[model samples]
Target: MTEFDLIVFGGGTGNRVASAAAEAGMETALIEKGPIGGLCLNRGCNPSKMLIQHATVANRVREASRFGIDASIDDVHFRGFVREVNDELAAVADRKAQDKRDQVNLTLFQEEARFVDDRTIELVESGETHTGEEVVVASGSTPVVPDSIDGIDEVDFLTSADALRLETSPERLVVLGGGYIAAELGYYFDAFGTDVALIDRNETLLHREDADVARAFTEVAEERHDVYTGHSATAVDESNGEFVVTAETEEGGSVEVTGDELLVVLGRRPNTDGVGLDATNIETDDRGFVATDDRLRTSVDGVWAMGDVAGNAMFKHTGDYEGEIVVDNVVHDAGREVDFTALPHAVFTEPQVAAVGRTEAELDKSGTEYVVGRAAFTDTAMSRALKLDRGFVKVLCDLESRAVVGCHVFGHEASILVHEAVPAVRYGLTVDDLANTLLHAHPALSKLVQKACADAVDAADRTTE
Candidate 1:
C-alpha cells in the first residue's frame, strides 16, 4: 500500500486539481489510463477543432467563387492532414505528461484507478493500493453506444472519438444523432467532399439549442448533407463492404441509408461506472454520474467529483470551471460554491453556433417572465461587406428587471462572438446596460451582438408600454 496526501482519478480537468494540490505542497498522485490531457486533448475538442479548421479552409476555398476569388481546393491530402494534427496533439500530451512527472510533489500514474473503499484506491493492473486523505474523481465521460440497435454488435461503426482521427474520408458517411457532435462531424466530412447523410430521431439538428437556432441549423445542414430528421435508426447491416442503416421515419415508414462508413454521436455517459464507484460508499445518480454538492464534494468525506462525472455540464470549459472550485475548496480550504452562471457552449459546425445562459424554452418552462430580441447578421454593415447569407442573434432578458438572461448566435465566428454576452449574462447586466455602455468597433462582427442588445432594449420597452 502506498499512501498519498491526495489521489486524483482522471487526468482531464482533474489534472488541474491535482496540479494545484501538488503546487500547494501536498503530495499528489494523478492516475490516468491514457493520455495526460484526457478527452479534450486526445479525442474531443482540441483535435476535433484542429481537424475542422482544415475543413473550414476547404469550405472557404470551395465557396471562394462567390467572393470572386476563383480559389479552388486542388487536393485535400486528407490522410496526411489528419496525421499531422494527431501527431501534434500526441506531442502536446507527451509534454503534459513530462511536466507532471517533473513536479516534485506530484506522481503520474499512467494506469486505470478504481475505488477500494471510502478513502482508498487501487491501480487495476498493478494491484497497488493507495490511500488518500482526499480524493477527486474527474474521470470525465465516454461516448454512449446504444445496445438497442439490432446487429449493432456485429457491425463496425465509428464513435465521435473515432471520427476525429479518421484518416481517409469515406466516400459516403452515415451519421447517427443530431446534436453538436453529429453536426460538427457531419459538416467536416461533407466539406471534405464526402457524401454525408445525417439521420436523427430529433425533428431538427442541435435539438437542444434554442428552437429558432435549431430550425436554422437544420436548414443549413440540409443544404449540405442528406438530412433525415425525425428518423430513428433501427438497425445496422453491412454487405459488400458498405453499411446499410435502416431507420423508422416519424410518419411510420421505413427508410434505408447506405454509406461507406457509419458514425454514431448519440451522446455521452459519465465514466463513473468505470472507476469502481460501486465498491465505495460514493453515491452516483441514476444516470451513473457521481453526485456532488455545490462545493463539488461527493457524499463520502474527503472525496470530490467534478467534470463529466459530476454531470453539471459536459463541455471542457465547464469541467475546467468545476476543477477550479474543487482546487480552491480542497487545497486552500476555501468554501467556494460552484458558480455556473452564464455558462456557455459552442458548436464548431460551419456557420457555427454559440449560446450563453438559459434558452427561452427553459425560461418559459420555469414560468419566468422574459422578453426576446432578435437581429440578423445582415442588419450589420460588416455582414453585408463580408457577403454572409445566414447569421442571427437572439437576446433574452427578464421582463421586469431587464437583466440579460440568455443569448444565442448562429453564424461565422459565433463561438467568439458569443463571449461578449457572457459578461452581461454572468453579471446580470440589463439590456440597456450592455447596449448603451459597450463600444463596438465599426464593421466588426461583434456589432451583431450590439444590434441584438439594442433590439432587446426596444422589445423590453415595448413590453412595458
Candidate 2:
C-alpha cells in the first residue's frame, strides 16, 4: 500500500486539482486510463471543433456565390483531413501526459482506478493499492447508447467520438437524437456532401434550446437534411452493406431511414458506475450521478466529485469552473459555492447557436415575470453586407429588477457575440447598463447585441408604464 496527500480519479478536470495540489508540494496521484486532457481534448470538444472548422470553411466557400465571389471547393480530401486532425490531437495528448509526468510531486497513473473505500483506491492493471488524505472523483461521462432501441447491440453504430474520427464522409447518414451533439455532428457530415437524415423524439431539433431558436434552427436544418422530428428511433439493423433505422412518430406512424452509416447522439451518461462508489457509501442521485454539496464535496469526508459525474452542466467549461472551485476549497479551504450563474454554451453548427442564463420556457414555467427583447440580423448593416438571411438575438429581462436573466442568439459568430450578454447576466446588469455603456462599432455584428439591449430597455419601460 502506498500513501499520497491527494488522489484523483479521471484526468479530465481532475487533472487541474491534482496539478494544483502537486504544485503545493503535496504528493498527488492522477489515475487516467486514457489521455491526460480527458474527453474535451481527446474526443469531445477539441476534436469535434477542429473537424467542424473544415466543414465551416467548406460551407463558406460553397456559399460565397451569394457575396458575388466565384469560389469553389476543388476537393475536400476528407480522409486526409480527418487524419491530420487526429494526429495533431494525439500529439497534444502526448505532450500533456509528458508534462504531467515531469511534475515533481505528481504521479501520472495511466491506468484504471476504482474506490476500495472512502479514501482508498485500487489500480486495476497494477493491482496496487493507494490511499490519500483527500480524494476527488472526476470520472467524467460516456456516450449513451439507448438499450431501449431494439437490435441496438446487433448493428454496429458510430458514437459521437467515432463520428468525429471518421476518415471518409458517408454517402448517406442516419442520425438518432436531436440535441446539440446530434445537431453539430449531423451538420458536419451534411456540409461534407453526405445525405444526412436526423430523427428525434422531440417535435424539433435542439428542443432543449429556446423554442424560437429551436424552431428557426430546425427550419434551416430541414433545408439541408431530411429532418424527422417527433420520431423516436425504435430499432436499428444493418443489411446488404447499409444500415436502416426504424422510428415511431408521435402520430403513431412508422418511418424507416436507411443510410450508409448510423450515428447515435442520444446523450451522455455519468461514469459513476465505473468508479467503485458503492464501497465508499458515497451518495449518488437517482440518475446515478455523484451527489455533491454546493462546495462539490461528496458525502464522504475529504472526498469531492465534480464534472459530469456530479451531474452539473456537462460542458468542458463548466467542468473547468467546477474544478477551480474544488481546488480552492481543498487547498485554501475557501468554502466557496460553485456559482454557475450565466453559464454559457454554444452549438458549433451552421448558423451557430449560443445562450446563457435562464431560458424563456424555464421562466414561463416557473411563473417568473420577464420581458423579452429581440433583434434580427437583417436589421444590422454588417449582416446585410454579408448577405445573411436568417438569425436573431433574444434577451429576457426580469420585469421587476430589469436585469438580463437570459440571452439566446442564433447567427454567424453567435458564439462570439453571446459574450456581450454574459457579463450582463453574470453581474445582474440591467438592459440600460448594456445599451448605455459605450458606442458599439458601426456596421458590426455586435450591433445586433446593442439593438437587442435597446429593445429590452424599451420593453422594460413599457412594462412600468
Candidate 3:
C-alpha cells in the first residue's frame, strides 16, 4: 500500500484542490480516470458554450437584415467546428497533465479510484491500495439516462455528451428536456439549420427559472421550434432511420414527435455509483448527492467531498468556489464557510436568460415582503438601436432591508449584464443604493438595469394603505 498526505478523487475541478495542497508543501495524490479537466472542460460547459457561440454568430449574420444591414451565412462546416473544439480541448487536457508532471509534490494516478476503507482507495486496474491523511472525493456528476423509458435497447439515442460531439446536424432533432441544457443545445443546433422539436413534461421551458421568465422564453422559443409542453414521453421507437417519441399530455391526448435523432437531457446524477461509499460513512442524500456541511465536510473523519457530488450548486464556477472553500479548510486549516447568497446562472438560448438570488416565486413561497421592478427591452431606448424586439429585466427587493434580493434578465447578453445585478444582491445593495451611486451610460444595455433599479426604488416607496 502506498500513501500520501492528501488524496483527491475525481479529475475535474478536484485538480484545483490538489494544486492547493501541493502548493502548501503537502504530498498530494490525484486519482483520475483519463481526462484531467473534468466535465466542464471536456464535455459539459466550456465546449458547449464554444459551439453555442458559433451558432450565435451564424444566426446573427443570417438575421442581420433586421438591423437594416444585408448579411447572410451561405455555408457552415459544422463537423469541422466540432472537431476543432475537440482538438483544442485535447490540447488543454495535455497542458493540464504537463502541469501535473511539473509539480514535484503531487502524484497523478491515471486510473479509477474506489473506496476500500474510510481512509483507503484502491485503483480499479492494478488493485493498488493507497491511504491518505485526508481524502477528498471530488468525483463530479454524469448525465442520467433513466430506465423507465422503453425501446432503449432497440435504437440509438444521444445524450448531451453524444450530441455535443455530433459532426453533422441532422435534418430534424427531437429534444427530450426543457431545462437549460435542452434550451442551449437545441438553440445551437436549430441555429445551424436543424429543424429542432422540444418536448417537456413541464408546461413551461426552463422550469427552474422564474415563471414569468420561463413563459416568456417558451413563447419566443415556440416561434422557432415545435414545442410540446405538459407532455410526458412514454415510448421511444425507431423506424426508417428516424426516432418517434410518443408523449402523453395531461390534457388526455398522445402526441408523436419524429426526428432523425433524439437528444435526452433530462437531468444529471452524481457519480457515486460503484465508488464503494458503503465502506465509509459518507452519507448521501435521498437523491444520492454527498452530504456536506457549510465547511464541505463529510460524516467520516479525514474525508471531505465537494463540487457536484456535494450538490451545493452544479455549475463549474460553483465547483471552483467550493474547491476554494475546501482548500481553506483542508490545506490552510482555516474554518472558512461557503456563502452562495448571489450565485448566478445563465441559459444562452435566444432571448437569453440570467438570474441571481431568489425568484419571485421563491419570495412569495417564503412569505417575504418584496416588490418587483421590471423593464422590457422593447420599451427601452437601446432596443431600437440594436434592433432587439424582445427581452426584459426583473428585480426583486425586500421591504425591510430595501436590498436587491433577486435579479433576473431575459435579453441580449443577459449573462454578462447579470453581473451588474450580482453585486446588488451579493452585497445587499438597496435600490436606493444602486440608484444614488451608479449612473448608466446613455443608449446602452446597462440603461435597462438602471431603469429597473430606479423602478424598484419608486415601487418600494409607494403607500399601499
Candidate 3, residues 1-465, lDDT tens digits: the string is 988999999889999899889989999999989689989998889899999999989988988888788986768999999999988997998899789878979999998779988889999999999999999999899888777778855679998988989999989999999999999998999988899999999989998899889999999889989999999888899988999999898888999899999999999989887688988888999989998988998988888999998888899999999999999999999999999999999998767899999998899999999998888898877788878988999989998888999989999989988888889898989978876755677777877876788888889889333
The local distance difference test score of each candidate is 0.91, 0.91, 0.89
Worst 10 residues of 1 by lDDT: 434-443
TM-score of each: 0.98, 0.98, 0.97
Writing each residue's lDDT as its tens digit, candidate 2 over 1-465 gives: 999988999898899899998998889999999998899998989999998999999998988988789999888799998999888989999998998999999999999889999899999999999999999999999989889999999988899989989898999999998999989998889888899999999999999889999999999999999999999999898999799899998678999999989999998989988778888878999998999999999998999999999998898998999999988998778999988889999999989999998899999999999999999999988888888999999999999999999999998999999999999999999988988867787888987887888899999899899
Candidate 1 residue lDDT tens string, 339-432: 8899999999879999999998999999999888888988788888778988899999999899999999999899999998999999989989
Ranking, TM-score, top scorer first: 2, 1, 3
Better of 1 and 2 by lDDT: 2
Candidates' RMSD to native = 1.2, 1.1, 1.3
Score residue 462 of candidate 2 by CA lDDT: 92
Clashes of each: 0, 0, 1
In candidate 1 the C-alpha lDDT for residue 366 amounts to 94
Q: How far is candidate 1 from the true structure (C-alpha RMSD, Å)?
A: 1.2
In candidate 3, where is summed lDDT lowest over 10 consecutive residues? 434-443
> Cα lDDT of model 1 overall?
0.91
What are the clashing pairs of model 3? 12-38
The alpha-carbon lDDT assigned to residue 422 of candidate 1 equals: 98
